[model samples]
Every structure is written in C-alpha cells, then in structure tokens.
Target chain A: MPTRNDMLLLTGFVAVVLAAPFLFEPIGAGYPDLLQKFAIFGIFAIGFNILFGLTGYLSFGHAAFLGVGSYTAVWTFKLLSMNPLPAIVLATLFGGLFAALIGFISLRRTGIYFSILTLAFAQMSYNLAYSVLTPITNGETGLQLSQGDPRVLDIAFGRDYGAVLPSSDLFGLEMTGYPGFYFCGAMLIVCFYIALRIFRSPFGMMLRAVKSNQNRMNYTGLNTRPYALTAFIISGMYAGLAGGLLAVTDPLAGAERMQWTASGEVVLMTILGGSGTLLGPVIGAAVIKYFENIFSAFNKSMLGDIFSFLPESLQSGAVSVASLFVGEGWHLTLGAMFVLIVIFLPGGLMEGIRRIGALARRKKPGGGASASTPAE
Target chain B: MASILTVQNVNKRFGGLKALDNVNLEIEAGTVHAIIGPNGAGKSTLLNCFIGRLEPDTGTVIFDGVSLLGIKPHEINQVGVSRVFQTPEVFGNLTLRDNVMIPAFAKRDGSFRINAWKGVKRETDIEAKAMAMLENVGLARKADEIAGQLSRGDKRRLELAMCLVQEPKLLLLDEPTAGMARAETNTTIDLLKKIAETGITMVVIEHDMHVVFSLADRISVLAQGTVIAEDLPERIKGNPKVQEAYLGGAHL
Candidate 1:
C-alpha cells in the first residue's frame, strides 16, 4: 500500500507524463516516435537503477537482455500474432531467464571482475547474434516480419492481417503516433510504480546493504548473492520490456540494439541523473534521450542563423566552434556534461538540485524546507 | 558453567606460515573470555576459523552443539555466532537506525526473506525494536545520523547495536577497543560490562591489557601462534610464560 506521500508523488508523476508531449513540443521531442522512445528508455533506466543504483553492481552487459527482448518480441510477432501483449510478456520472461543465467555466473565475482564478466557475456551474445545465430536473428539484415509469417492469432480470428506488413497493435488498435506513445507512456508508469515499490521494500533495503558492505551483511546473517541476483533479473526484465517496446514501435529488431554502447547509454542516463534515488533514473533517461533527438537535429546553417548578428568572419568562427556541441558532434556535448556532473555533482543531477534548493532556502530565511528533505 | 564454544586441535596454514596451530579453547556460556596476543600471534586467524571464513587443516570447532566447519559465514551467523570487527564493520552508508534494523530483520526474517514489495516504514515492530537497540547503545539520539559521519566510538557502538540486535549465542570481538582514546576506552568498557551482565557468551581478542583485565573473566595469552597461558585474570598476570612473552624476563 502506498503512503499518502507516495500517492501524491505518483499523481504528480502521472500528470507530468500525461502532459509531456505538449510540454516538450517547443523542445522538438514531442513527436509520437521520440516520445515513445523516451518512455521506453525511461523504463530501461529505472530497471538498471534497481541493480546498479541501489545494489551498486554495474552490469556492463544489460544490452544483451535488451537485444534478447527485442528478438523475442519480434519473433513472437512473426510466429504468433501482431498483438504486442503476448510479445512483450514473452520478451520479459526470456530477458529474466537470460539475466538469471548471466547473474548466476557474473555475481560470483565482485567489483570490476563482476563487471568484466557481464561485459564478456554481452559481447559473446552480440557476436553470436551477429554471426552464428543467423538462423534465428537473421544476422546483419536484422529480423523483420516476413510476408508469409504465420501470425496464428490473426488466422484464428479469421483475419488475413499480412497483406502487406502488419504494424504492432493492441487488439486491432494500431501502435503508432499518439496511441503508441500513450501505450508506452502507460507501461512506463507501471514500471516506475514497481521500481518505487522495490525502493521502499525490505528487499530494497537488503540490496542497499549488499551495496554498502556485503561482507558485513554476510556476518549479519544475510546471504547477499540471492538479493543481488534478484535485482539483476528484475533489471534484466525491465531492459527486455524496453526492447519489446522498441520493436513494438518500429517492428524491427536489430542486433545493434544489444551492443555495448546501448548498455553504456543507460548507464550514462542513470549516473547523469543520479543513482539510488527514485526519480533520478527517469529524469536522466529523459535528459539523455531529449538531447540525443534535439541536439542531433541542429545543422551548421541553423547555428549560423543563431549567430547571424555577429560579423561574417566572427560568425563563421562561432558557428564552427558551436557546431562541435550539436549535430553529428553532439557526443562532445554529452561528454562535457558527464564530466561536469561527475566533478561538481557526484551524486548526479539530484545532488545538483539539492544544492540549488539549499541555496534558495538560505536566501529566504524561514523558507519551507521541511525536515523530510534529506540532510546533505 | 556450560561450554558454548569448543575448539579442539584446529590447525590452519597460509602458504608457509602457520596462521593457527594446534589451537584448542573452550568458552563458557556466560563468561567473557579474552585472548591477548602480540602481533602475528593468530588471534584474527582463530576468529576467522570460527566464523567459517577459513577452513582449518585439522581438528573441529563446535558452537552451540553444531559443527561450524565448512559452513558459510552467514550459516555460522545463523547458528548464533556473530563477530564485531577490529575496524567496526557497520554499514557506513546507512543511518545508525538502519544499521541496527538490518540485523534485526535478518534475525526475525531469517537469512533470505523476499519481502520485496512490502514497504519498510510499515514494519513498525522492526523500527521500534531497532530504536530500542539504539537506545541500549546510547545512540538513540543519533538514530537518524548517517553512520559513516559518526565518531569512532559511536561507530563501534553502532556495530555493537547491530550485533546485539541478532541476540547471538556467541559474540566474538576482535580488538573491539583497538583504536581509542582513554576516555572512549573507559566508556566502551562500561558499555561492554553492561552487555556482559546480560548473560551472553563472548570471546574477545585484544592487545589492550586495560580493556582485557577490566572485562575478561578469564584470559588466554597467545604467543607464536599458540596458547602460552590460560587462567583467571589474576593468575594469568602472574604466569611466567605470559611475563616472558611480553617482557622476555620473568621478573619484568
């Protein structure tokens, strides 16, 4: 049962998410496709936080689960039906199973050694899916629905669905544009709720204990391994669900989605937002995805327009310099942001917010800074 | 008094060095038995063996009528033997209240409870029990403080609160007062004496003779990876073997 405070927080979260498309319109990410990506990746980051943020076990291979989920969801579409419900459920289950296997092996080691093990497992999966698993994954061309796909559910319903190619749907309601974004958005809310419950749960407390001191937890009569593995599997399921959504939105599953860089992207989102806090991962995911979409869209001509007031020579120089922070060179801006956050806000954006809030409170004597605000 | 812990002819070696050799000791169910030793005399090694951290090459360790050999460290703890480390191994990142609450949870819910969906704040009984444990350790005032921010003495007290919340059958202390000022040490001694009166069995390893004599009902002097003397505190003080081990001369 949620406390009164949790209920309020959830209400505010739902309100913001519901209004996100309108609110983000001026920022150029309000389109259905990009908004859906935001919701999908937000779920991904929230799941990653369960293990990495709360438990402090950095699995460098989470992309493997994501890839597995995408593959499973796409296969379900090809083999079963165009409905995303069955596909997503299968994807989550498969992702959890794969994570359980990997976690069983990887969690035996700690710190960097465990990270390396996860990385190796993910890389192995990527290599196999890219090459040897061509029969299942369809290799470099990627996996897509075939014209002769046996969508059993459609046939059972006496509907000849694959005249061309079928888009994912929820019981004949097509998953595209506003409807798709809303579907992903609703799923993100559910994922967020589960993460919130875990954060406040005793199991979450044990995971925090594992992060704080596993050795001490052991002597305190707790087995740390099962707790860690459970967190890993839960996070893996979240990644899987994200991948399923990706396939649902696009109807294509690519091996590239399971690569190390994809895993690293979620890590960036979590740490950049703040680990170990409830809203941090979702905020981080939004910030990263929003920047990825908006920053890459700006061209040199656009930059030149923004600096048109300056002299010709000076303006060109300014455009060239500023170009490194946008468009194809957007990674430079991301890297700079990461470095700044790590140095100034070690706890991520949450700490930065807290510091700013503290400053605001100091400026106003007898401000409404309650006792509940976490002490620095 | 009935024996709560019995170690018989246990031997352990790390590469070429004998970490513990032919070690045998029995701890009474309700007495504080102190083991004093110079550096490298295997006090830590012996304690590690008891907690299943190191498997002895020979002999047996029986605690509360069950063999502790080859079991996991957590299993040892579940069997009712808990240790307080030399550096105080409380969860530094958690609050002092949570540090106690975790051990309380382990004791009540056992080693692996999957209460993942239940809110921690709803566990009022556990919170009250943890608060009571903090009060016993004189840290109820600092319950909300981050444990890592606490002073060394308070951190040690928090560790004690964590251990005591489990209500272990045997409590092992490794240099519990290793790094402390005189005043802190005195306070620790008083706290420990209060704990001793509760009838919990304890095996304390210490280099501080002041702490040892003040709390130990009996003393065992370890030298060169073996027991050199075992007797009441008064007799152990007068034993020539202990005198030679510390001073290299009987008179000194």
Candidate 2:
C-alpha cells in the first residue's frame, strides 16, 4: 500500500539523518558541521515545497521568514536563554504570524503577481533588517547575544546550555550538537509525515481543486483565499523552524540567512529534486548539500591531485574540466540539472521512480483519460 | 403551491446594455420549468442573477424564503440553488468520480479542512453517492474516466451528476442541451424526468422546442430581456406573443 511506502520512506529518512554522523565518522564525511546544515536546509526546502508545490503558488521571498526566524531566535537567546527549544518555538510562531500577514495581502494577487509581491516584501524586510531595525537586527552583522546580557537560564551568555546543566541532558540526552541534530531530524520526520497526511487529506484535495480550477471551487461553495493563506502560514512556520535549527546548531545567526539568494536556494532545492512529491525536496537537499560540501571542497589543484595518474601534460586540463563539475563553475552543472529536470523530467525524480515502478508492475502510464494520477 | 424561487422586478444593466429589464418569474417546487427565448433575450443573464454570479441593479432573488441578493455564489449554492452554465464545467483534471466527489464531499462536510490526508478511495459513501448520481445520468460505467474526455452528452451528464450530488432545492440550468445530438437530447429528457421524481425543483432554459415540449410542465418565452409570455405547454404553443417572438418558427 501507499501507506507502507510512506512509512518506509519516513523511517528510512529518520534512520539516515540519525545515523549519518556516525556513518560518516570513519570516512570523515559526516562531520557535525555538514550534517547539521543538511538536516536544517532539508527542513527549509521541504516546508517550501508544501506551499509552492501543492497550491502551485511560487513564492520568491521565503527567505524573509527564515531571516525573521533566525533574528527572533537570536533575540530569544540574548534576552531570555541560550536554550534552542524556546528560540525555535518562538521563531516558528513569529514565522507563522508574519506569513499570515504577508499571505493576507499577497494572496489577494495570485500567479506571478503573488510571487513578485512576496519577493518585494522579502526584499523590504531585508532592507529594514539592514538599516531601520539595526538595533534589533544588528544591521548587516545580524543579531548576536552580547556578553553584557544576563542569562536567566544558561550559565552566563557566551556559554552553551551544557555549562548550566552539567549533566548535559535537556530532553534526556546530552544537550550537545548531537542532540540538536536528533531533535531537528525528529521534527523533520514528523513534519514530513504530517505534510504527507495533509497531502492525502480532503483539505489537500480542495487545494488541488483550487489549483486545477478556482472558479469551480468558488461555485462549489468554498472560499479559496483562506485555504491558501492557511497553507502559506503552515509552510512559513516550517521554514522558521528550519532557521531556528540553524541558529540552534551554530548558536549564531546572520542577516545573510535571510538574503534573497537564500530564499532562491530553497526554491531550487524543491524544484530540482521534485516539487509536489514527498521526499523530493530531501533528495534535492542532499544533492545541493553534497555539491556544497563535497564539490566545493575540490579545486583545480585538488582535482589534479585526485587524478594525478594522468600524463603531466593532460593533468591540468583535466583538473580544469573537473573544476567545472565541482568548483566555482559548479553552478553551470546545477543550471544544467535544473533545465534537464524541467524539460525531460518534469515530475522530477519522483516521476521517474513512478515510471519505473509502473514498468515493474507491467503497466505503462495510463493512456487516454487517465493521464494524471492522484498526487501523493 | 408556493414558488420555491421567486424573482421580482430584477433589473441588471451591463454598462451600455440592459442585460435584464425588470424580469420577474416564479419557479414552483417539483416542477420542470423551461425558459425559451431568441438570441440575446436575457435568459442567460436571468440565470446568472438567480445563481448570484451577477448582482442585479434592482429587485431580489428569493429562494426557499432566503434573499439571494448580495450573497456570494457559494453561499447561494449552499442555500440549495445550483447552476449549470452554458459551457460544461466538468473539471478537466479530475476523473468523473472525482468530479462528482467534489460537490458530494463539500455537501457532506462544510468547506475547508485537512481532508487532503484522508484517502478518498475509501470514502465508500461518497463513491456510492457519486455512482448513484452517475447511474441516473447514464455515466455510471465512466466513473473512473476523466471528466474532460467524456463525450458531449456524457460531459453534460457528469455536470448534472455534479449538481445532483449537492442535493440542491432548486437547479438553474442555462442551455443544458446546447450541443447535444437528437439522441442525447432525448436521453437528457429522460434523465431530467428521472431527477424530478426525487422532488427537486428545476428551472431549465432551452432553444429546442421538442425538448421544451417534452419536458416542461410550464414555459416562459423571453424577448429582448423581458418575459413576453408564460403559461402551460398547450397555451404557450398557441400563444401569439411566443409565435411572434420566434416568428421564424426555427426554435421548434
């Protein structure tokens, strides 16, 4: 059954996220630095998928909330505690609240206009954070906990939560990066499962109906704007949680976290892997994160060393060609990947997998009236 | 018998054109009423006003003791008035079953929730209801077929099934048999007769006199955005006003 596939996917994801650090320990691949980024970014991209994917509304400024979440979390740390829990929670609440405001206005204009409006608001937020709200935003440097600030919970400001409770257990585990990773990973799994459930729910059907035909939905006696706004706010909260996790893992936040490019990065992740399909964004996140970690780590010199067995004359050219695959020009690869996915693989990897699955079951994609299948 | 839907002195002006001019009519419950008219007679405009798609410049549309003026289209729909537009509105992306399931789902549960997570395949009652509606409209076997791919008659049938699932107190149909073949039209007549036995009120507009003569218990002839004649089939068939309105005798 589809339910089994969903469970298998969820369990496989949790297992991978949890066991990654340990698995990578021997190969020096799963360092805390990289694993934490993947888990958090995965969260951001997945949340973005729920909004842009299901409703067919493409938001160009999602990073605004990510920035808002990080700023809120850092403020929570500065004024309240070094604890990540309250910071993530408060940040998520603000993300939802902020999205509700934006959704209220932006939802009035749909399609490309809605996208442009969200982008403009995000840019506006970025501008304000850089200048007008400098006192709280700390300008371009981003908000950070000051040494002079009194810590109500943790042992003084600069110290970790570990310093306050020497036993190192907040939720019955060592209150360290490991625990944060597990906590975030657990939340990601739960969010994914919830999104899957929502995708299959009647409400999800209405949303698809809205996407397919808004006029008909209205005639069917459903006010569609509120439904869309609800979806936007929920997805926004998920992005905020992802941002909070970033601040939690690193214990520092920056304005660049909310940059327009950061927002585009989530969009890229969702689309490159697949939008509107469960696990699509996760695959996308892994791909992008791999490029960030593994690909960027190589260069002409390192690549030369990687394939030093070639002739001395051919070595340098090979390294340069390989650089196009991994280094400064890796964007070309990403761009190519996106174009190919859009053209040949419109459904992303999910459709390909589905096709293979169908082939395995001795059925070609349905011809005639059954061209489209119910989305998972 | 009391009228289920009452339109009184309704006036709709569209910029430079008077689309509907002081139109007044009453649709009795359990009766199949037909509105026959020539091109631009405002039959479609009147239907739009009744379904709350277009606001009238004056007068009110009273349905089941409720005022339809200023009510949103969906709210009007919930009040038991469903409209089938001139063009078939069967959802292109959904199966015939899914198309029927939409109104059934909306009728059974109030609008907006997390129904996305539930498996619609398991909603036996919804499927049964959709199938039953489909069966009456002669589309039961095409339940799993995509609605957009249905033949003209089947698409109309699907639209009818969609409207029927809502269980409306009154149905407003604008040119329901507009593009159907003669064979399809008779099937439709039979279908409408079958639907009426369930005690639902229906207001149908037709250009085909055979269809009008076959199904309508009462008929109203519209000309230049106003009703020129209203009476039983026998009376309207011989009415001089109706004869003058469709003087070419082409509608027959």
Worst 10 residues of 1 chain A by lDDT: A365-374
Q: Tens-digit lDDT track for model 2 on A295-341?
A: 66777778878879999888888877778878777777778888888
Worst 10 residues of 1 chain B by lDDT: B243-252
> How accurate is chain B of model 2, given as a TM-score from 0 to 1?
0.92
Off by over 4 Å in 1: A368-376, B14-19, B249-252
Would you give me the overall lDDT of model 1?
0.92
**How much of the true A–B contact set does each candidate keep?**
0.88, 0.59
Docking class of 2: medium
Off by over 4 Å in 2: A1-5, A22-29, A154-177, A306-314, A363-376, B114-124, B138-145, B181-183, B248-252
State the C-alpha lDDT per candidate.
0.92, 0.80
Instruction: Compose the digit string of candidate 2's lDDT tens values, residues B1-252.
Output: 889988899898889998888888998988999998998899888887777768899998898899988888778877777778677886777778788888888788766555655666567798899889888787877788877787888787888888889998888887788888889888887887888788888899888888888878899888988989999999997888788787755555
Per-residue C-alpha lDDT of model 1 across residues B1-252, encoded as one tens digit per residue:
789899999988889998787999989899999999888889888888888878999999999899999999899999898899999888989988889999999999989988978899999999999999999989998898999899889999999999998899999998888789999999999999999999999999999999999999998888878898899999998787888888866563
Model 2 DockQ (Cα-based): 0.54
> DockQ of each candidate's interface versus the true one?
0.85, 0.54
